[model samples]
Target: MKIDAGNVNAVPSKRLFLSIIADYDLNRSICELIDNGLDVWTRAGRRQPIVIDVHLDPDEQSICVEDDAGGLPREDLGVIVGPGQSGSVATAHETIGIFGVGTKRAVVALAKQIVITTRYQHAETFQIGFDESWLNDEDWVLKVHQVDDLPVGTTRVELYQLRLLLDDDNIKMLRHHLSATYANFLTNPAVMIRLNTVPLEPRFFDNWAYPPEGSPQRWSGPMRTPSGKLLRVDVIAGLSKESSPATGDYGVYFYCNNRLVAPAMKSFEVGFTRGQAGLPHPKVSLTKVIVSLNGDADEMPWNSSKSDVSTKHHVFTALHDWLVTVVKHYATLSRTWEGQWPEKVFVYDDGDITFNEVDDFLTAKRAVLPNLPVVRPRLPVRITKANSGVAQAKPYVVGLYEGVVAARTLVKQDLSQRNWLAFNLLDVSLTGALKEYLVNDAGAELSSLDLAQLINRDRTVSADLRARVPLPDPLWTKVEQMGRLRHDLTFGRAAPKISDEQLAAADAIVSEVLARLFDVKLAA
Candidate 1:
């Protein structure tokens, strides 16, 4: 007997088909068919235009995806149905399709029966049917035949006996997914995609800009995969013009090989709130970062379905620190932009700064930010109750009464503490109200500390605040006296005691400043 090396019944059962189809949904299955046409364009040297049209007939419960991107020849009919057989790999084509199961999985996921028609060069239309019986049978064989005439360089796939219902809501969502997934291709002149008779337009990310003081918003660098493949990464980060928080349009978008793998990610996956202070508040939602990775498709960090990033990939791990730094930088800055947005942000680039749409902003000529080491700024020593024997909220003019109560409670042990506490409260209230008058009414950037220093000495910002805030000379004398007292108390030195009459005078100054700036009376 001739000893033949035993073949171990490697043919997969019909259940494998069920498993494959179950892994995909209606949107993902449709995308797989579109991706097939795109791979054909890449294999054909990408010299000619590729037009794909998707038609949905809800009455018939069928879908048709037709593409003019180099139809399949007769020889490919046999191999395409087989699992683990990829034409791109066999022919050494640079394409996103690495596995051969995409088409088979997509077609079976949509319907129980599929008909594929193709016309290549001079050959007549080659037609093949994968019917319901083929799925139920154990035979791994398929039949192909020549059919009626079709346009050359065309492939059409029609699915019938749909497994799921075709509805208007799902069709609308599919349109949005296709527009965003193939956004880069839609921008090219040689490619056009239409769904249900409507041509899809690219979704552009709108950003905010300020012309004067340049804030860092763009960066580009190179990273090498573990297999030594080079991945060129370009990052554009800024505040969005549309300020809807926790929406799908906000957060970091990750694109691989011009295909959006991940969209609007704001979680630990993109290094948000990982050992840093970040939350999904409206200000943090204003932050938008687009990370585009262009290189070999196999080396990208995307998962199998191209729906999300693989956090464990070496290329993504190499980029974690950079992503974290930029995200935290912009998230912190956006939190401080609530009231100052009008004074600091603009809609368009004004020749001095290049803040435009995300796509154009990346392609336009600009400076490439160097990969500088992130030098964490030294944090100022916090004055806690343990060190300064006092704890108070930072004065910003909105809430001054809380500081007064805290100051009074801190000195309640002394016999003459009531008079001292009254003076301190009057001083803090006057300082905060005067600064508010300068910043809000007078249109200046003044702080409580700046107001105190301005009364004592001459500094550029403080002097400007004084010039902008119009106060009478008598009020200026009271402000000067309060500023001196604040300086002495802050340094823990002894200051002359104040009587009830002086405290009353300081109270009048506080009330006057508040009424002028805010048009509100002091609390009785």
Candidate 2:
């Protein structure tokens, strides 16, 4: 007999087994479960008044919630408290509490002990108490008792061993959260919720009353989402004075399945529409943009943590495109209303090579010009054999007069390519030859050399060369003064000083010359 007893095994009862494995965080979990449960209850067409009461006592470190909802039946209590129960599945509707593990598991997560009191309309009130230690103890059991003095239509849940303290700010935020969550219930008047001693208020933006005097212009369009869903857009613009620049004040709200979710940002595609308007007014804050997207039970994009929507889905893409188009359109409208055009215009032509050719020629000349001692005196002097008979000699002495003249010639040549007339006038000022030639050859002896053609053919000639090349205006005055000196010097007359008035006149003349020569307007 003793040997046979060793082969026997003990099997724990089902109730005792699940009780030991119930999860922790029971208090917080129970609150969320109740919230979701109320959502389901309202949607199911339950006519009874639903009330949620939350009580927190920091002194006792306890939190409790009581609801006047359809209490759980005695038979269903096991499934509600037990693990892996799905009571809502039999109802065939999308219940907020889809998984049966919600309330009990959440309660187990929050506190070490919990007590649930429930009463059905026709059934006797029942109380069930469980401790955290009983979850794993094989011999432990849940204490269930029936009572006659329980409230007529209330289900109460009390949690002990709180992990988070509820302060004033937290309470206020909770109230706001509940009001937004249950906005649809406000119109029904059958649902009432209270936290501490204050009653909760539900806020719905759609019902916001407009000012009585203004005729607000309403703008609406269908925004197509990438997922092929047509999201309707509703905008209220012209809320301000029509004659005022700020009259374009508008509010854009997004709704999904009739519930306001979040404010839309301009960075998002939906926000692009607002940018298009180019409204001078500042953009509305995120809190001001009310967005509500209808969420279905099948849409897993909306997880329990409803902070963000799933971007990978088609709905997100569609929403993005719609917003961007709206912003673009608004920007265009703003520009049109302001009667303004873009300040700058850019033109590209493939066939224009004249400018390029000029640039290329200048680059080539510059590369070779630096090496030519004729242009730059600082270049190393080079000795060359003259006919192999004379000793190696430098061709010409580096005289300041000759060097200045050479530099002036190089500038003249360059400017002549673009504007020959300006170069010629500058040359007349630099060289005494212009006056000498004009005076020597009377009106009858004009040569066949067309001065304009000659200047145009020489691309290297420039205004600086003309100004410094011994021109004739006031040249006699300089020459006579030089001749009166003790030693007779054959250096050409000194170039005239360019005064401010002369410079201004030269600049204006050059501009006009270039405009006519190139047949193009010069930009100031």
Give the root-mean-square deviation of each candidate in angstroms: 14.3, 23.6
Overall lDDT per candidate, in order of appearance: 0.69, 0.43
List candidate 1 stretches off by more than 4 Å: 1-7, 90-94, 206-208, 211-216, 346-524
Tens digit of per-residue lDDT, candidate 2, span 1-524: 34554554555443443353333332335445555447446454566777778776667877788887767677766754665565564234433444455565566655667888888655799888777567656553467789764565567888887656656676666666556555655556777777776777776443222222111223344434433333444443222112122432233444333333332333334443333433334332111223344333333233232323445545555444433333443333333222111111011111211111112111121111111112212211221111111111211212212232233334333242323333334333323223222333222243445433222212233353244333343533333232232122113275333443433443443333323322212221
Model 1, span 331-443: residue lDDT tens: 66566554344444444344333343323222333333324333333111221222222122223443554444344334333346566677777676766666555565566
For candidate 1, the per-residue lDDT at 118 reads 88
Off by over 4 Å in 2: 1-31, 34-37, 78-95, 99-109, 134-145, 204-296, 305-524
Measured by TM-score, the strongest candidate is: 1
Task: Give the C-alpha miss distance for residue 349 in model 1, angstroms.
Answer: 5.9
Evaluated against the true structure, the overall lDDT of model 2 is 0.43
